[model samples]
Target: MSFLEFSSDAFIAAFFLYCFGFLFYMIAIGGKKWSNRDPEQHVKRWGRVAYIVSTLGLVAHLAFFFTRWIGAGHIPTSNMYEFMTFLGMSIMIAFTVIYSIYRSPLLGMFALPLTIIIVAYASVFPQEVQPLIPALNSIWLKIHVTTAALGEAFFAVGFAAGLMYLLRVVDFKGKTKEARRAQRWVEFTLYVIIVVISFIITVFVFRGMGYEAEFKQMQVNIDSRGQETTTEENVQYTMPPIFKPYNSETISMDSFIGMKQPLLETPYWMDGVNAGRKLNTVVWSIIAGSLLYGLLRLVFRKPLGAVIHPAMEGIDPEDLDEISYRAIAIGFPIFTLGALIFAMIWANIAWSRFWGWDPKEVWALITWLYYSAYLHLRLSRGWQGHRSAWLAVIGFVIVMFTLIGVNLIIAGLHSYAGV
Candidate 1:
């Protein structure tokens, strides 16, 4: 097989191994209640096995990464699939480092599933190798994106630890209405995470099954004189088209929902192919996620929080909070250097300007500012424990938006970086 083909196979193997490791970690954490032997010994034995398996998976993942790099003849951070895979690998590496310091099996229980979800999400994006565009043909592409991904991976660890801290500290069983509401919100958040994972899975499954839809839409564009004009173009979508754009023409039988053009048109600068199809995929993903979440709720017949709370018994909230802070503290400077400083240098070289306030750049700045505030509020304002943990969680959310949302939803100079 070609190196690229081998890399794909290795990645598939690594994914399954990570899932196995996650199962082992879960069993290690939850087996105490059912075991007749010393609980600590059982946990230690199972946790050790899980760690060993995870390390092997990491090795396989590294093999995949390096092979892809060799095959592509460049750092594999140019597009959504490559970047997301790198981010997943970086998260695993960060988790390994933190787990070594803290020796917490509970960390793996939270982190592993997230790692799996990230890798699975990456699979939803196109994986075919493509030649680098003119802008991406620079050494800084590797240096900048790699460091930023690693930094964000550390932030992801903080998010997982922060979530654990919240679950441990929150008085979910308390009789107060506020406590119940908070618990419900936590459960809802868990459902949302599951929903995202389900959406990714659904996309991959349906696409693999050759599901497709096509229609003709009146594509809007600006002429040389800066006047708006419309032309007919064939649009293809990977999902069933439930909705069609208002300016659509020559409709297909697959379009179940149709509407007229809205008063507000898409911005002239926002020139992505098949914007309507992208919106359709998003709508279907949400619907699919909601249905999967509902089925899971029906099967469990209980709040997700109640199911997750039991495994959190031996974890300390304060330690998790501190770890979360430390992760962000370590990551913030790295992120600033790679995402902001390096990005600006690269932009100057490529775009003939230091800053253009592109959507990606703007969101990167926002992420940096959000984390800066997180650190300031924690260190200077004496905000520790719950407040700080919440900030860590929110900081990661901003990181996600900067990484995924800006690239997908907002068309900018960085649009080529997306699939």
Candidate 2:
């Protein structure tokens, strides 16, 4: 089989392993019977199992990814799918480091499933070999994509932890049963630990299996034209054939302006004339995967509000609020540097422009504003607990919109993403 096939097989194996890890974690969580007794012993006991499974899953995922990189002759971040995968891996690596330092196995429970979902969604897109354009050939692409993705990955982890903290508290506050209310705080803490893990997974494992396409079009000597003909024939292609994006498909460009038309509509906007096609494949995959996962989860009788669960009441809502604020404090500066400063520097070097109000650029500004407001509300207005938690959640939503939604929805120079 081909290298793509080999890499795909490895990826599939990793996916199954992640699912197994997630399943075991769920089993372990349920086994504790948090409602009946002190869950500390059970959490400690199962936390160990969760960590082992998470470690194993991470190892397997890395193996598959590294193998694909060696097979493909470049870093996987060349396309949207690869970027997500890399992002997922980077997030997991960071989480592993944090977990090792903090010994937070509860974090793993929440993180692993998110990663699994992201990867599984990414798997739906096609994985194939595609050449990079001259602009993307720079080392800066490596630095920019990696740093930016890594920063986002960490923030996502923070979000998961924040969500967990809130969920635990909310459950305790809401539940009317007297028996359930007594041990509400401890159960909530366990759930917070799980949320921490889940967010980490969303960034690292799930995003790891994303897809991308690479394409190039060259003038071919068709029909032995001793006399060249102006009649145009256009061809269309896709990476993972499953990425059925456009209905009208390909049409011959009337001129340079005509060429820009398709580029405008698609998800990717790269350097070269035809570069965006491959990028679009990756963008489309991300959208498709994200939507598919949401739909599937909804279909499976999962409650949207319950997405983050096992609420921790004893941890103190104020403490949970503090954790989220601190996390954003750490993440915001890094995000600014990576997503703005670094991105700007790279754009100047590669594209000959220092700054443009491209959709991506504009969204970055919006994200900055969103976070700024969050900080303002927390500090000036004393936004705490659910209020701050809600802001933190909203801030991440803005971040997501900037990172993924902008690429897909808006049109601009950054359209190379092939949204």
Candidate 3:
């Protein structure tokens, strides 16, 4: 087999290993109550087994990474698929580091799922290695992207830890205003996770069904001399189009559920021709997510919080809070170096300016600032437990929007990654 083919095999292997690791971790933690064996021994044995399996998954993942890099003749961090897989790997690294320090089975329970979700999400994008653009050829690309992803991975662990803390501590039975508010927010957060999973499921389902829709949209391009040129491009959809491109006509569309045409045209004010497609995806994901959430609600017949809160009964809220804080604190400096410092160096080299106010750049700054505030409040202001946990949770949201949402919602200099 070609190296790329072998790399793909390794990637698939890693994915399954991570899934198996997650299963083992669930057994390690959640199965403790029902298992006939002694709880402490069972947890220790199973958790160790889970950790080794996950580490093997990470080793397979590393093999995939280096083999792909060798086959592609560059670092595999250029596109969405590459960067996200790298991020997932980095999360596993962070998880391994934390596990070594804490040896907490509960951390693996949360962190493994987070890694699995991300790796699955990364797989949704096209996997073929493409030639780098001129702006991406610099050494800083590898340095900045890898480091930034690593930092973000730690933040993701912090998010998992924080969310777990919320699940453990938030009182579902209390009648007070604070309790009700916390319960609602926690449920909403869980609902959002379901939504992400729903979107992933929806994409794969439609892809498996060979769904296709196409539209022609007028696009504008700017050259290095700042000259504008116009061209028409064919935009393909893997999912059904609830909305069509702005000022564009259908090239062809495969009907689904007797819907042969788009329900609406995108507003002209959205600027980019791809905006309509992005908006359509967002709407579909929300719809699919809601349906999935409804089904889960029907099955559970209780708030998702109430269902999960029981499983977290033995886990310590204080430990979760500390894990969240440490992960973010460790990540903040690394993020500053990669997302801010190295990025500015790259920007200056690529665009002849240190800061261009690009959407991605602005969001990166916002993320950095938010995390900085988080650390400041955590250390100086003595914010702990619920408040600190919430900040870590929110900070990850900002970090994700900076990483994924910007590429999805708005296209700027970083638009190539969306391809």
Model 3 lDDT per residue over 273-370, tens place: 67888888888889999998899899999988998788898888899999999898888888899999999999999999999999999999999999
Q: Report each candidate's C-alpha RMSD, comma-separated, in the order given.
A: 3.2, 10.5, 2.5
Q: What TM-score, over all chains together, does every model reach?
A: 0.93, 0.65, 0.95
Please identify model 2 stretches exceeding 4 Å from their true place.
1-9, 34-38, 171-319, 379-381
Span of ten consecutive residues with least summed lDDT in model 2: 252-261
lDDT of 1 at 371: 90
Would you list the rank order by TM-score, best first?
Answer: 3, 1, 2
Candidate 3 wrongly placed segments (more than 4 Å): 218-231
Candidate 2 structure quality by residue, lDDT tens digits, 130-246: 677676777777777777776676666666566656675565334567535533543443433334334344333433544223333333233665755333233344333232223
Cα-lDDT of candidate 2: 0.60
**lDDT digits (tens) for residues 1-419 of candidate 1:** 88999999999989999999999999999997898999999899999999999988899999999999999998888999999999999999999988898888888988898899999989888899989999999999988998899899999999999988878877777879988877876777787787788778878776777765656766777989999987887776666666554465434433323532222323334355566666666666788888887888789887777768878887877789888987888788989989999999999999999999999999999999999889889889999987887788778888888888889888899988776
| Candidate 1 deviant stretches above 4 angstroms | 221-228, 250-273
